[model samples]
Target: MNAVKTGSHAASTLEKTPVGDLVDGKGHSSGAEWLTRYSTSLMGVFGTPQRVLVRGAGCLVWDADGKEYLDLLGGIAVNALGHAHPFVTSVISSQLATLGHVSNFFTSPTQIALAEKLLALTHAPPGSKVFFANSGTEAVEAAFKLARRNGASPDGTTGKRTKIIALEGAFHGRTMGALALTAKEAYRAPFEPLPGGVVHIPFGDVAALEAAIDETVAAVFLEPIQGEAGVRPLPPGYLKAAREATTKAGALLILDEVQTGIGRTGKWLATEDAGIVPDAITLAKGLGGGFPIGALLTFGEQTSSLLAAGQHGTTFGGNPVATAAALATLHAIESQRVLENVAVVGDYLRTGLAAVDGVTEVRGEGLLIGFDLDAEVAPAVVTAGLDAGFIVNSPGPRTIRLAPPLVLTKDQTGTFLAALPAILRTAKDAQ
Candidate 1:
């Protein structure tokens, strides 16, 4: 075992031992060997592991083979301040040392502070409240419950307002309740008889949204930018329209900001871009800067009062360490002006990608970007990117998504831009 100091923090010691070497009393030196062990030990839901990443710092990660790649995906937009951000690391360590886990029967200062902070950041109205969860899916689950609770008659009944509306290309989460709201058939097909009454409408179609959302609807769910749907943003005025329709139809408007919130789009909430306040918003991903925390913010007294005591709860949600990490992540984002950096670097990448010969279109806001290729070679492009010391993702046959760290700089993006033409050429050749 070896001790390595990262960045300017010498007190922190990172173990340099290979993780594979410690498993099963056998030393597995390479990524392929560890992956072979992984197949037998882990479930196959996510397919093969892309790479056995050993360590990461800032916007870069090293694979088991010691190859370095610029991380453009940022752990699917979870690593907002980038991997191993020193401030977040220090806060977590300190919190763990002082007070780690406490059952939900009790609460800590950090938990209260985080809830207050989220409310303040979202500019939530008075009586707004926050419910902490362990991940984005859990937060969505809570929001689903909020919708159901809102639909209950004054005397408590179920079937009154049961229908929920979601868009054509939304990816809410994989949980049964969230899965019901998700628009993809492949994900929902396996788990049929899903909490019924979820209908999928065309993405960003105002008329369809207006028509689908009526008195019978309990809630209307939307993503400001449909990230898994090739980074497609809703048409302008779409969120405002949804808000209006839901309000008029007496339905709750819930925005899933799991991938787009917490400064991923240069704003605390992507809903801010549209200047409309929703009944509730689900957050995760960048909230704890990779420390695994999610939250559901319910706006106003009416919406916040829907879920009463004992209606929903979690065992490990809002623990001190997670909330402390979230506070540190928020502090770093503000003090370092990471949102401004996101705007500058995001524009640079979008413009450069559009100029590339093989790219047909580039879409997204801030650091959550996507582009289309001239051909259906997105998967090939992902492979070529990994091989060329860069990380990227393809959500569809012709679409590639890049949700780089909010702290990514223009210089780092220039490197990817310089390598992209060649990477695209290689992908096209492979296709």
Candidate 2:
């Protein structure tokens, strides 16, 4: 790893300075001026950019002014192999140059191989099928349609089986069908009258789930660990109970592994720990190693004859470049034993964070960890972390989430751990 030793004192103060001052008044090249242009050119969904990162390698990134940070968030857990892994880069570049994309009506070796690999990892038994999409939301949407198709009555009463059960704090995606399943009212309210019949239930409440799910429901979709809701893991018996209840109700069980899969939880799929096979599994995030790709995996006969033949399609869903990147990502994780590293480093991170004062709770497994402060000081801690040359995120006002790359080393974890106390102290002082 390359270390940007611009002196700790200077680096600490740099974060507090305006980007304009750091750029020496160079117009377009200046970070502030470029951001000004960005504000004019781009939409305001993310608000103002926090930091203008220029480059990255492994688990570290350098800002516009050459300040380095230990990136603990890992691009919101999308960079599973970390930034610019050699294998990922090699596969993407080679495939792009050779045969980048093709129409969905066509097939490619990488696409078939990636689907086969996902089926194998899912342990979905032979003859399982996979559908490719461009993001987690698309994967969920595909599975949602499939479930609706499977739940249709012999009397052709598909419309009545439209209700789908989702958990509170679950985030499937921003698209219409996926947005319908996400429970956050803020995200759904903007586009009110979203696809009707989607119901939200409290996460981990088996009784509530049992009560809500009935013959009217087409599917029950949930995140194994609610990522955007702050790394909240489901209770021990909750997942099994959900599967049983959904099965009894004749509803499909869909597990959204977008943020929790691909060794982030020290397992190929976090649902493996539960020992219950969902009717469908949606995956993305770490799957492409930063390239864009998503997959929906279904087992046995539940694959559903949904959408007929020409009902749904995407222009770049299963492009060769993206498929190759995912294939390489899977190969690298297996060959390098990255899941074991996630387990070891995750334990270290959890133990380290638990030792901090004012940390009321530490939850989650593997590298997808979250902790609560005594107060709503997460934003302050984020600022302090940036000052201390680290990167992190707050999923909520009181919860700090750390979903670093699986390639994060012991030394990298130690750096953030060692700086955490001072970061907390700084946050506390601000109050």
Candidate 3:
């Protein structure tokens, strides 16, 4: 028998591979056994593993058992250009080979370029500033601190307007500051004592917003479309009303575009045609096309100056690699004409879902869509979809959420529609 090498770039034989693996009777690793190991080692925050996904390409992924699925959730709207996109991978690889990262104390061209590009995309006014972070939660947390600073008095000690207003049914993030703004009781109760002085008002209700936002309010946070709450778009003129109310009350309007922005809605910004400028905006999810980057953009000196030196900092927020990946994502969105594709294919998906017998209503814009099931069988429907080699999410017991890659094609949309009838039937039969 020959000696098998382990670590240090050496290959190992079948019997010599280190631990953390399960072998069946035939001596092959199994996904089910791996799930058992995963459960034993990792916390059950997200519950049991689905398939132990191994590889992905385009709008498809394969599980540990080599089963393929058309990824409709896109990792919960994180994979903007789908998986292992060549353009993004090339940029990330090139940037990493050239300069992986530099400390925040130092800056890189990729980071600076991405900031400028994002500011331009927002059509931000002069003197706007972008604070980079690593995830959607961090971006919201940064904006939370910015709002607190805005509430501070001239000397930066006392405060006149210390309260922040967030909409009910909002899903900002899971961090303390972000969670404080989120309205879900289940998500907040376990993590009590959240950053205080946060108030929740009915989403898109002009009257509730007006009543809550007063001169003593620091900021009002709202999502253009409630992503995790079943993709409910704001009523017309709601954002305009919020802007007028906040401006009159001397409160800043912060839009959490974490899930809705970056061309997900077939627009550069979901709030593009709303005709109101947000004091600040927090963005993430699809920004890096799955590479992980978040940003807080403050408009004008009024909001930008709130975060002075040493106010907020992140170590890996704007690393050169992530920034480069983001740049590629943005460029691909444009050069690939993906926004146009989203409009055509998204409408197709929306219309198809609407035509389904079990679908009650379809809500959302562009590639981000959610539908209500006539019956309370969304989980069953999702399971049926998985069994049919499709990927979807049940955000609520009756809500099916789909935030697929922006590059989803009309053919893929047709394929999903073709398979949905049986999936819905399976759910109904189970019920």
Candidate 4:
């Protein structure tokens, strides 16, 4: 493997860094040195390695060479109870020991129970059905198909309503159908000729939304809070307006809560606060506490009957182990009172972070927080934070996002807050 070293430190690092476990009787090399092996084995779609992470516990992780970091991103909001939570481990182990995978042909008690729990949390109308998948993309794919199916003419004739309206700067997922709903050109350009029938509009513009909605549209896909676009929440009353417009136009309103759902925003469902019943909701990420699982929820008869048995299915959608993990995560979140912690500590951290030198704006609810950096040094800031034993993400050139574990305490948040000034200074110097 080639060691692309730079500067005076690079010379010593290349010579001294260990090859797997050990160098030539010197120190160990586990952080960046392991990147060569990673490049050889894995795809480069995600770009260069930040660090060689090895293991993690609640709100903290260790790298390959024993370097520790406070994991504030929480696997991009996937870890609800933080890493290696014992409750999650025990549940998975017990469920795996008993009934792991019976497939969709047969359902386990755990799977059915989790589905029912999710349905209750959403407080859907009289009848609601859930279809489980293995990731956020699959949940969205199911919702997309359901919308298309629901809008199809009864006789399967021509002139079927197949169009979907998505928000500008919205990120649904990476699949062809989901990508069509995403508005970023850079993420969509290479995957062109994608599934069509999707159009984008300015988010938070109620008038534009009303103008766009019509009977020709099948579904309106939106996020209560835009996670990838740096955790931007929907404008006040925007969800209600979307619900009204879609209902009036006979279109389904699909809320993609893959990032904001499962109490990330101090609520079981972010849409609940809006007091509007959406036609469908897509969920994943924190639902499984890092275990890959997703679900598509349909409210009321019109939406629930959209997909028939054979119309949609999954091989490992609600496998017992994944469902068990999800149940454990939910139980822990509730029993441990983690959501309260998120509400209290998240506000504290946000208030503190807003006072930092480089931060220009602070936004988000509960454990999911985001801030605008004063300069385009977000990536550099991420690097500096990592060096200072903290982990964060910069979704854009000037946007810094933090979706830490719901269990993160103010003391842990203080650690990051204390180091942020120095990290900002380093990032500015690098820029």
Candidate 5:
């Protein structure tokens, strides 16, 4: 009841202000005002804004009005250990105070340590190297370029081996190279002539993949669990078949682990669940806890000596503060046994979701869960959940996605599950 009461205050503040007014106005100092300013100057890539959160701790965030919400979306599966964890904050602060950033030509211990840890955890072979970037899109772009560099045909030029095989309903990123790999027409139509030489195959279809990938294909790119496509899991043996096929064709295998890596999937990497070791793995999202950082890991002979000294670089890609934040995040996940928590809480949420009415199916692993609605009422369900003081998402017309913080407790989940049936009823009534 207290949460319910507090939630109203948050929502009221959001509703009272016109998003456009805040974007154009000045001298306003509220979160709503900040959001308005954000909308005006920021590109309209993500559509309209929601509640402007002012602060967060653990799995909870408070909107501008100070109404608390159980963060079930978890910043789209990026808050692996939850928001504002002391370890992450302290490391970031200390690192910033010591040395904030340095160019790529120079190296820092934090960046080197984080890269080494990632490579070690992934079981990459000796000499496997990492190239840091600023975001998931950039990481994927780096992977794409790396895939191409090591994929030249016998002609010694990238003529025959030019195509990349991506999955239908797959979301790589929005940058040019990564966007070419993404299958969503809505995100790609406006920006056509995208980096060419890419093909799309239906996800979870081994035969289709076999048909599409061949000698000319340079690499096979896949998300072990398709997070943006309603958290669909790869069918058993699909990844194995892909690996074998790519190997047979001499095409590399790239796993886009941006959303499922770093313990979001109950494992260090989702590909581990499939027993496949990809040539290159693109990672971001939860890697930095809440800090901005992305990485590309290449192993064995596939770790081509591409990207000459000045080929690709980012000013803030491996900033000491973000790297420190990531190192702390990795340590906390292992020391605090956060992956175990993800498994326990994730299963509980999945079990509760299965018992809910109007849910046609439940899928995904770890804290990333998705349920299909019996009808096209997921939006209504999301709205009802919001009114009930819980933050959730409708990833599709008939699917609800819950990527709750790993720190979310069983009691918090119970609170949401207890309110779910009424939320469903409310959604139906609204429909």
Candidate 6:
């Protein structure tokens, strides 16, 4: 078989090929061809495509060129049960066939059931609530609104509390409201005059948190593990400390568990390990196991009632199909004992990664693993990993992140471990 082609020649070839010829599974188009067309037609925000993936199953995927890769990134922690999971797919299909969508005017049983299940799993108190959205950013946006709504004065008058606190390395999302809470100057600079009053404090600094949080503060947003910051977990006891400070200051403590929730950390929510029930938590990434569902769970009646009906809504947030997908995902996680698998396999991956020659350190819990290389060649490592039939990510110059499917097996992990040393060498050489 011919290797995938690239450059101007491939782009011209794609331009000449009939549009109908690009049909899926036909093997009539190459990765380079699809990517060239993609560059011309799509936005440049994400840059060029690495490989044009055609199909996926479990923890593996195939590019358009018929190349197979062990998907170690798991779509950046979105594909919890891995790509095209049978159970999730079936549920979504069935729901779509039966009743695909309904406006916010009416709610479906599946949607209600999912909300109830999330509340139960999080051990939320009576009168707690769940607000559904279509993505992590949407969920964060809703949480932002909830925080603002809860920002009322001690006597319940509006506008007294306006400030919101987020960590320095935090990545909430790219949407306006979510972006305002995000700390990266680059992401926020482009869109200036963002909804103000959002502050950034040093991550994992309890003293800083205590000093920054006050009556004027409406909420403190935290990610138990910062996935985009290279899977950096918060310092021990930080969650509890934040909880205490926020409670003392009468501010809400919101956990952004977009990448750490839904059993990604060997538990339903990473904050659970810290034994703190936050005022609100935003969840996505793995919630629907690649089906694109997000939610904000409020812990009690007061916080839950902050956003009254008509205050916030989404057209397709809790559509029957999405709810069904989320429900099926939860069912699979429980029935398959995937959380147990995450604990056992996660430890294995971490241990094996630490032993790799070029590895400097490993951080993260469950399947969401990240490691630092002795040398700053993470981008090169990602390239080498792809070339070696393994899919990985470089969140930073020195960090390689792995948030593979929760169902990833020990043997599959062993396969990557066996090949990592050579991939590292190749990366260093290329660098």
Error of 6 at 199 (Å): 0.9
lDDT per residue for candidate 5 within 211-296, as digits (tens), equals 99888888899888888899998888988999999989988899999998989888999888577777889899899998999998
Better of 3 and 4 by TM-score: 3
Global local distance difference test of model 6? 0.92
What local lDDT does model 6 show for residue 81?
A: 97
TM-score, cand. 3 vs. native: 0.94
lDDT of 6 by residue, 1-431 (tens): 99799866897898887654665545477778888889888999998889999789999999988999999999999999999998899889789868998888999999999999999999999989999999999999999999988766555567788999999999999999999988888899989999999999998989999999889999999999898899999999999999999999989999999999999999998888697879999999899989989999999998998997678999999889998999999999999999999999999999999998989999999999999998999999999999999999999999999999999999999999999999999999996
- Give the runs in model 5 whose Cα sits over 4 Å from its true position: 1-41, 153-157
Model 4 CA deviation exceeding 4 Å by range: 1-29, 156-159
Judged by TM-score, which candidate is best?
1
Q: All candidates: CA RMSD in angstroms?
A: 3.9, 7.9, 3.8, 8.1, 7.8, 7.1
Q: Over all chains combined, what TM-score does candidate 6 have?
A: 0.93
TM-score-best of 1 and 2: 1
Q: For residues 1-431, what per-residue lDDT tens digits would candidate 1 score against the true structure?
A: 77765553543323455455545557646889878888999999999989999899999999989999999999999999999999899999989978999979999999999999999999999999999999999999999999898679766667589899998988999999999998899999999989988899998899999989888899998999999999999989999999999999999999999999999988888778587889999999999999999999999999999988888999999999999999999999999999899888888899999999989999999999999999999999999999999999999999999998899989999999999999999998997
Which residue pairs show collisions in model 1?
A: none
lDDT, candidate 3, 237-292, per-residue tens: 99999999999988999999999999999998999899999999999999999999
lDDT of each: 0.92, 0.87, 0.91, 0.89, 0.86, 0.92
Q: The CA-based lDDT of model 5 is what?
A: 0.86
In model 3, where is the ten-residue run with the lowest total lDDT? 18-27
Tell me the spans in candidate 6 whose CA falls farther than 4 Å from its real position: 1-27, 153-157
Model 6, residue 119: distance off in Å is 0.7
Candidate 3 residue pairs in clash (backbone atoms < 3 Å): none
Model 6 per-residue lDDT at 4: 94
Scanning candidate 6 in windows of ten residues, the lowest lDDT window is 18-27
Over 4 Å off in model 2, which ranges?
1-28, 153-159
